[model samples]
Target: MFCYQCEQTMRSDVQDGCYTDKGVCGKTAETSDLQDILIYQVKGIAQYAQLARGLGVVDVAVDDFIQFAIFTTLTNVNFTSARFVSLVQQAAEVRNSIKDKYLAAALLKGVEAEVPMGPAQFDPAADMDNILKQESVAIVNKDHDIIGEDANGLKMLILYGMKGVCAYSHHARMLGYRQDDIDAEIERILTYLTSNPTDIEDLLNQALSAGHLNLKVMDLLDRANNETFGNQEPTQVRVTPVAGKCLLVSGHDLHDMHQILEQTKDMGINVYTHGEMLPAHAYPGLKKYPHLAGNYGGAWQDQQREFAEFPGPIVLTSNCIIEPAKNYRQRIFTTGPVGWPGVRHIEGGNYKPLIQAAKALPGFKADEEEKTITTGFGHHTVLGVADKVIDAVKSGAIKHFFMIGGCDGAKPGRNYYTELAEKTPDDTIMMTLGCNKFRFNKEEFGDIGGIPRLLDMGQCNDAFSAIKVATELANAFECGVNDLPLSLMVSWFEQKATAVLLALLAAGVKGIHLGPSLPPYLTSNLLAVLVERFDIRVNGTAEADLEKALGHAVA
Candidate 1:
């Protein structure tokens, strides 16, 4: 198996991906192959779904399945080969059902519906062994020889961007938000990939289109969260653990977090947010639960150590789950798109099993002293004070704005973000989101006047908030976003970050400094295109990049 979709992918001078029995994330070759096959089947579903939509027939179930299947294939989301096998079979069934709908609609219209070739018409084998042998068609690099590396790289970009789209869309759908137009566009992009187009310009444009699509999905999710849980406000969240029975809920699902908070209410089990769920504390609806305790640990990469040390049950609500260690394996539970071979999974939003596990385990021995950090400076809160911010900018009280955040990983060189945040001038305001904030969030940057210098904007999806704030600031300054004294230093990990990068480019934001390393899938030619078009820069030393953004030599 071969995979290089994440920042942690194995890389060397001679090799660019994980080509062995297991990947850096502990995903085995069999699991990787199964995920590939599942995606191929989802492509088949998209083939039919796109045609059906063209005939004025839309199946929400098919669209939902498309989002879910793609989301599960995201790095570190699901590593269960058996689960992927089931998903592959389920995808085929969903595709056939949609195919029947399309055929019936075409028959009613008295039009000949031509069947699409490639994945659209391809059939999978009955068993996992036979399925694994179908790598010729399922492998990501299958077209590397025929299409050349550059075009293949662009195709992978589009595919990975779509994965990010589906991940965001899945979260919105879970919150009971549905948009037919968004669903149609998702199918359109997936169907476009079935053709194996190699035109460099068109592939890049389509990749950017995925970015635009992601912007819409992010906006939908933002609205979903705000409308459901109330708009986020500035709130102080305790980062230290509290005493009593507790359950640590991680990942980026607010709905899951809310469910756990509700079910475990008054049950003597304290629910603590971890990882991306750190933003949940700012939501009024969720924070209303007194039993919703503080956060535990940092980002996803450090979970193995953190989870083992935490003295309560752990619940994974979404992506970024690693293989569980024996220390907490029995006490941890997986839900939503996250899964592991032996970990118990919570189905249908049920929390009884998870709550029981928490009850059975010994929680924290005693309550730790209250130590807190600030979050929830989303677009709404920031823009609400637009006048003050603009005034500060005019008076030179706020010299610049640095948006330094993205997915965090266990790789080296990530300390660049910490140092970058630290070196940001005292007069500048730092806006951050995603798990990457764990790097420098604890460090005190104080505030510029009344506004905090370091602002924690929600999760990775909340990159939408940054984009909105930038656009608003541009409008206030009567200039383009790039013309403002702002810089985007993005550290990407998986497909979600890819989608976010595309969105920034699609929005015409330029001069983004991206690292720890460029994607291995991107050939130098493709990288050249991005640099020439978008002014994208590989991150240098934190001090060097900070000086470049500030246009000065630091003392």
Candidate 2:
């Protein structure tokens, strides 16, 4: 198996990938192989889905399934091999169903159907072993020498970027939001992947175009979250457990969290948020639940220790799920796109088994001293204080702005983010989003007059919020977003963040500082294009980057 879609991908001057029995993200060979087959078939489905769209036969279900299937294949989302195998077969069936629909529609129009000769016309193997045999020609680098490393790397940029697009779109779709333009664009990009293009420069341009497409996906997701939950408001959430039967909901699926909260209401159980679900407390619709307790744990990486110590059933609703540990193995649950080998998966929006597991376990014998952290300072919350923010900057009360947001990882240099946030001057304001805030969210940064120095935007999908905020700020100042007194110090670990970065570049938001490590899939030449075109740079020490952000020249 070959994969290099995350911050932890194996990299060096000479090589940039993970081609082994296991990936750094803990994905096993069997699961990775099945994921590739699923992607291949998804592309085959798209080959027909795109044509179906052109023949006046639009299938919204097919489009949603395409996004959902690609979302399942993202890093650290689904690790169950059997599930992927099933998805592969389902993909082909969906493709055939759509193909038939398109042809029938064409015939009814008194016109003949034109069938494509590639994936649209091919038959996939029914079993796993023969499916593995197809990998020789389907792998990302199958034509590496012919296209060279640079072109191959650019292709990966588009492929992985779209995976992120699919991930965000899937979350939005779950909440009943989707645009045909965005859906068709995602299908179009996947169709491009099936052809195996080789022009280095052309592929690079397409990658940037993907950045443009990702902007729309993020915008759709932002609207879905805000319109569904009401805008986030500044709220203090308790971290210490309340005395009661406890159920911990992790990952970032707010829809699942709401459903669980609804089912478990008045059941003598206390629902607590973990990891990315911490932001749920800020949303008015979600926060209205009386039983929805406070947050627990730090970030996704700390789950091994935190989950083992928790005294109740833990439900992972989305990505960033690790293999379940023995301490709480039976009590652990998976839902939505997240999966594990032996853990129970709750489907059809049922919470009985999970609620029963919570009742069976001994939860929090005694309440710890209550600890509170401030969150919910998303676009709505921040912009509500726009007058104060503008005055602070106009009066030189707030000297500069820093956007230290993106996905989090367990990599070594991750501590750089913690240090960078901690060392920011009292005069600077920090706008943070995603799980990366786990690094420094616990700390008290006080406030700049009335505004908190550190503002917690929602999750990774809130990149849309960040972009809106920056654009508005720019307009307020009569300048470009890049001209604002703001700096982007982004920490990315996976494809969703990759898609967000592309959105930033597409919007002409420049001088981005990206790290804890560069994507291994980017060849040096491709990196040069990003550096020159976007003014992108790998992160240096927190001390050095901090100085740059503050306008202090360092020798």
Candidate 3:
């Protein structure tokens, strides 16, 4: 029952430990066990996808299965025992269907050729460890497929990142951002999970390949976001809380965000973005509303403190919901798959519950006059300043770029992010998104050419912005992304960060320094694959890492 896959782990050290005692995140022990099992089974699906890719068999259903597995793992989505069990069973069925049909065909072909491909051995109810071990092997080098703890951690990072990507990709798909090649890779990863290879070296290679495939997925999503939604532009928003009937919107659903923005436009209900929703101000469409306000607080982990004083109802569009506090009690509305036992859920873009709750509450009174925060400097906005950026680079005005954002949590060690931001060289620019940005967003980092040293690039979902900026920087510099003087120091707290990591790998951005901690769910085989291909490393002290990043040895 151990789990610390997010930034919310209670442990002080970043050794990937978890405090499963008394249920962190309000997940019961049984539910935690079920989620572990579900993750294990999905690894099997990842094996199957990898194997199918090796066989040149591409299928769409397999892609859907991968997305569903990730979505099911998202925060605050499926806490009920029954729903968790149903998801595990559903994953098993998908694995069985893919394996049974494929195995039968291979065996029959072998028998007809007097070659007997090997005895058909496929079972869904087989030992769970065996499935996970096999899945681990599929992502590693086939010639050397044994996995260790580090490798496992790396693989989990990549897979979970892909899961996060799939969630956003799904949303973009809703907005018409579809790419068959990305879908195929998802299928390939899932199928490969079913393979039983034990070669350590080979398994490691497969892990790198997974990262490569993720690059394609990220690119597809980037195009979807920019082409469909328009590039980001600089904008500012107010942070004052709305009184009376207020609706707090959280999560990464741009569609739901837009819907709420529209529904509450004239309803006297003020809408404030929470957690991942803070980046909504970067969008041209959503920012048009005069009623849309600034971010409410930090990541989902801070809800207990941030939601305490709110006077109105809150609507969660996705994951990362903390156990409700008394102030927000009876006023929380869950949307999409996000659920809490007593909270109301609004399904399928439904706003009736949100509207009703908004009306039922006393309605919003302005907590204070609008206080503005600068945001909306995503890739597009950066590129728009392309000429100025290029000039600054040539003049040595901007020496280094640091992408210092990811999930934020309640853990004590997360303060390192804030410390690092505070210590960043004044000449360097820090780009951030996600709740992690809360650490430094309020700091007094002066601007370079009117752009704050702490630049808000949108949400974790908008890691797309980070990727786009990196790629564009490489293009502008006429060198590979690795050649740019940019460093990535991120803190991951959920599966969405998983997808962003994969995207980074896919783009061949190597030697990333990650931390606050590593995920507790990964196995060694996966980490080895990452080390071999991407040279990924965990973060150390902020001063140490910052010095290292700046090419300065200990003084």
Candidate 4:
């Protein structure tokens, strides 16, 4: 009953021993334990893939299997016991396959290590102490055991970062962007973790490599998105909730967002972006819908309360669907791998369930009778304004550009984003998406010339926007993206963020200041690799970090 897989971990020296009592993300010790086992098994699959590759065997089915295992362990994806159990069972099958093969090759060279079984495969499923004891005893290298709280903490960080990376790579493959180099790295690390736990330093190196690989994966995705959807440009998004009947869409799937907008159009129901859905307004095809209204709600973690306040049907297009309360359960629709046992699930590129639910729910009375939030300045739209942007910069009207965006959650310290945005000067332009942008949506960061300081790019997937904008800026200045006067201050909370981060790195963009906190999945060594190769850093503070980024102060 011990865990530390997030930016915030409970203190070890608490009087009540509260750290193990409650995980920083409100995860109970049991959930954390199970997640550890789940990862252990997934690593085994990676090892198996390595073995299969040496023998020349890699299949799409195996790819899908690996994707599912990684997705299950992602942040806020599966918080329930039932789903967790299902994931463990699937992992167990993969673990057993790897174990069986390893056993078969026991007499072969470099195959003497004892392969460990996943937790679900361990006997006495209800016994907790025995599970911990098994983990303690199964260490292949006594010299590198997670001997104490501190050691365990580092290992958890490395593992968690890998989980996020796996999730992103999985999504990119879904979009037809795949890289063999990344797959090789994933197999290599997974093999090492399951063959035998190694020294902290070695594992840390693997973690960094994972980040480096993620950069490649994300770059592929950025290309896939922009090539398919057209480059983003500066454009305005309507923020007013439509009058009579409204549908709030969330998550990172632009395909579904486009479908919903199409179905809801001219049907009297208004569609407003929510969560990652906020970026949909920037896509030409999607934003063309006059019914596409402004954004509603905040980050995923706040959905429990935010959904309750809304009176219309909500369509979750992807991940970060929290457990819903009874009051708003009927009005919420889930699509594309987002499932709540009772909530209506709309599948197969169809909007029938969502449209039907919207019809059944009490149509939302337009809340924006007066004020509205502006969004829709994605890369495509932004590039369209490239001339004006260049003119502004030449005229000394726009002095700085900050890519202040990433995922958001309900955590308290998340205010770092809000503060950073608030502190941005009038001469700076802030481009945003994901829930993190909500922090400054209500703030008054003055614009460059007539443009508002806060430019809302569409959802997390629309990180495609930032990538395109950077590429465009570099082109305008006749320099590489790394040489442009732009900075990426990202806050990650899930897999999509993983993909976006990778995309940023893959583009060879450097000196990204990421924060609120670093990811749980990166080992210290992995952090070093990222810092050395990509110069990525987690956020520190609004004023200090922002000033340094703006070249106004020493960081």
Candidate 5:
């Protein structure tokens, strides 16, 4: 149950995590232990898969499974013990399948196969109780005292960063995209973890490399989303509910949302986007459906209250799920990698039962007065109007570009982002993604040179879109991104955001402001390295940070 993987993790002298009964996110010790064990088994699969890959023998199924299995373990993704228990066995089965292929390849080459000890060559119990008992050997802090906290912290960063990569890679694979190099890196890091290496320099370098892979996965995922759903365009979505049977879909999976939208189109049920799905409204294909209503609620952390009020069924397509409140537990459905104990799971992308539940429930009583929020300012929408942005900068209409983006959490310091967004000068524009924007998105900024000052570039999963737009803007101006009038004010919450931060670090992007509290897994030594090397800063007050970001912009 010892988990410090998210921004909401407990921290104190005697308690660095939720090792007691349940985590702050409501994950039980049983489920947490099973997640750790499942990760261990996945590493075992990687141990064999990497060897087989060397012989030019690769299994797409194994690579795909690796991504999916890791996605399930990410914070707020899955809380069901049975899901993890099933995945543990599934990971072992995948490992054995890969092991046989590795051995056969070695025999053909006349090289004796050597499957290492540890996760690679281990047996698991048949049930959940025994699986939890075996967690002692598989904990991330196994040598925290002996190897020192700094080394353990670096390893955890690598592990967590790799987990983010797995989640992103899985999203890309769902849209028929997966790279062999990405697969190799996934296995490379997993195999390294089996040894628990402690060299600080090696660990740090590997972490940066993991960041690079995360960048690749994000790139792949961006293409997958655009290719599948069509490039996002500017669209104003109605914030108020329309009268009808309704299903509110949350999370980062567009593929699932598309399927659900298609299946429920003529059923007289209205589907509204929640959380990360807000940007889905801008896609031409998704917005074509008249029943695809606008966004509802705030970020993931507020779901407990928000979900209870929504008049109909809700479907979570991916991570950032809270423990279901009993009020609407039966009406809630989990799809994709998202899971909750008693919540119904819509396997194989089926939404029939969910549609039925929505029909049976009392939806919004009547259409309310229209309230609208503009979204879908993704990379394409912003880049398509590049000349206007460049001209605005040249004409001195824009002083700086602030990317106030990242995963949102319910922690106290998170208010800094809301205030920062509110305090940005009218001459500057702010871009947002993930759930963080919910803080200040409703606050109007009007437009500059016909461009909205506050741009919503899809979800936190669309960090690539933000990165791509920045790089292209820099290119258009013939300057390094650092020399451009841009400052990345990132707020991180979970492993996916961690992976995004790593990508920025790996790309040598500097002078970025990151906060809402630093990760607990980063020891002071590692934090010092990031500060010194990357010039990353902790966020202060909104006024102070805004003045600082504006002051740093290159005119």
Candidate 6:
């Protein structure tokens, strides 16, 4: 098995991926191979789905399956090989159904339907062993020798970015949001990928197109969240534990969080948000629940210690779930595309089993003193104070805007984000989103007159909020977004962050500082293209990068 889709992927002079028996994320080779097979099948589905759309026949179910199947392949999302096997089989069935539809629609139109070869006609092996042997079709870097490293890297950029798009689209769909144009773009890109095209310019354009597609998906998700849960408002969330039976809900699914809150309401369960779910407390509709407790832990990387130490059951609602330790494995539950081999999965929005486990365990022995952090500085809330922010900027009370946040990870260089945020001048406002904010959100940055110096914009997907805020600020200043005093210091860990990065680039936002390290899939040639065209910079030392952004050394 081979995988290099996340920041934690193996890298060295000789090897750049986890091709061994197990990955750094604890994913077994068998699981990795199965995920590859599933992805290949999804491409087959897209091949036909793209054609069927051209014939004016669209299947919402096919679109949903494509989104879900790709989301499952994201880093740390699913590690259950059995689940992938089923998904691979289901993908073939979906592909066939779509293939037939495309043919019939062309017949009705009395036009010849051009059926593509390769993945469009792929037939899954009958058994898991044979299926695993289909690595020739499933490998991510297949035909790199023919396409060369640069083209392969660009392909990976588009594929990984598409994964992020699907993940966000899946979340929006759960919230009852659907956009056919977005679906068509998804099919178009995936179908394009099947041909293994090597044209450098076309590949680069398609990669940027993925970023543009993600921008739309992010906007849809933003609307779905705001309309369904009410716009986010600035609220201080308790970080300390409360005394009672409790349940910790991690991951980024607000819909699942709401369901858990509803099912366990008034049942003596204190529901606490963890990781990306921390933003749940800022939504008026969700926070209205009396027992909707506060945040419990930092980010996803620290979950092993946090989940083990906690006395109640833990529920993972989305991606970035590592393998569960034995002690808490029985008490932990997976939902909505997240899985581990033995962990119980809660299906159909049911929480009875998870609630039962929470009741059986001992919750916090006693209430801890109140500790808080502010969140919910989404676009709506930030724009609500636009006049005050604009005035402060014009008056020279706020100098520069540093958007320093993205997916956080366990890597050593991650401390760069913390150091940069900590060292920002008092005159600069820092806006952050995703788990990377955990690196400094607990610290005090004071305020710029009436505006909080630090603005916590929701989850990773809330990059939409950050982008919206930047555009509004640019409009206020009567200049381009890049012309505004905003520097995006992105710390990426997974595909969702990749998608966000692409969105930023697609919007012509330049000079982004991206690190802990560049993706292994990025060949030096592709990196050079980004650097020359977009002025993208690999992250340097916190002091040096910060000085470059501020144009002066911090005191």
Which number leads on lDDT?
6
Worst 10 residues of 3 by lDDT: 112-121
RMSD per candidate (Å) reads 0.8, 1.6, 5.4, 5.3, 1.7, 0.8
TM-score of each: 0.99, 0.97, 0.82, 0.78, 0.98, 0.99
Q: Candidates sorted by lDDT, descending order? A: 6, 1, 5, 2, 3, 4
- After superposition, candidate 3 runs with Cα above 4 Å error: 2-4, 7-23, 36-66, 88-158, 242-244, 521-537, 552-555
Better of 4 and 6 by TM-score: 6
Each candidate's number of clashing pairs is: 0, 0, 66, 23, 2, 0
Q: Residue 9, candidate 3: how far off, in angstroms?
A: 5.1
Write one digit per residue (lDDT tens) for candidate 3, span 268-348.
666788877877777777878877766777677778777766656787767877778766768888776566767777777
User: What alpha-carbon RMSD in Å does predicted model 1 have with respect to the real structure?
Assistant: 0.8
lDDT of 1: 0.91
Go through the candidates in order and give each one's C-alpha lDDT: 0.91, 0.86, 0.68, 0.66, 0.88, 0.92
lDDT of 2 by residue, 293-407 (tens): 8999988888989999999999998888887778888889999888889888999899999999999999888888999998888887777788899999999999999999988
lDDT of 6 by residue, 1-555 (tens): 889999999999997999999999999999999898888888888988988898899999999999999999999999998898889899999998999999999999999999788888889888888988887788887778888988988898999999999999999999999999999999999989998899999999999999999999999999999999999999999999999999999999999988999999889999999999999998999999999889999999999999999999999989889989888888899999999998999999989999999899999989999999999999999999899999999999999999998989998999999999988999999999899899889999999887999999988978899999999999989999989988999988899999999999999999999998999999888899999999999999999998898888878
Tens-place lDDT digits, model 1, residues 1-555: 999999888989987889899999999999998988888888889889989988999999989999999999999999898888888888888989999999999999999997987787767788899878886788998888998999999999899989999999999999999899999988889889888898999999998899899889999999999999999999999988888888899999898988888898889998898998999999999999998888888999999999999888898888989989998888888999999998898899988998888898889989888889989999999999999999999999999999998999998889999988888888999999889899888888888889999999988978889999999999999999999999999999999999999989999999999999989899999999999999999999988898898899776
lDDT of 2 at 504: 87
Candidate 4: lDDT over CA atoms?
Answer: 0.66
- Evaluate candidate 2 by giving its C-alpha RMSD to the native, one decimal: 1.6
Error of 5 at 288 (Å): 1.1
Candidate 1: where are CA atoms >4 Å away? Answer: none
Worst 10 residues of 6 by lDDT: 135-144
* Candidate 4 worst ten-residue window by lDDT: 137-146
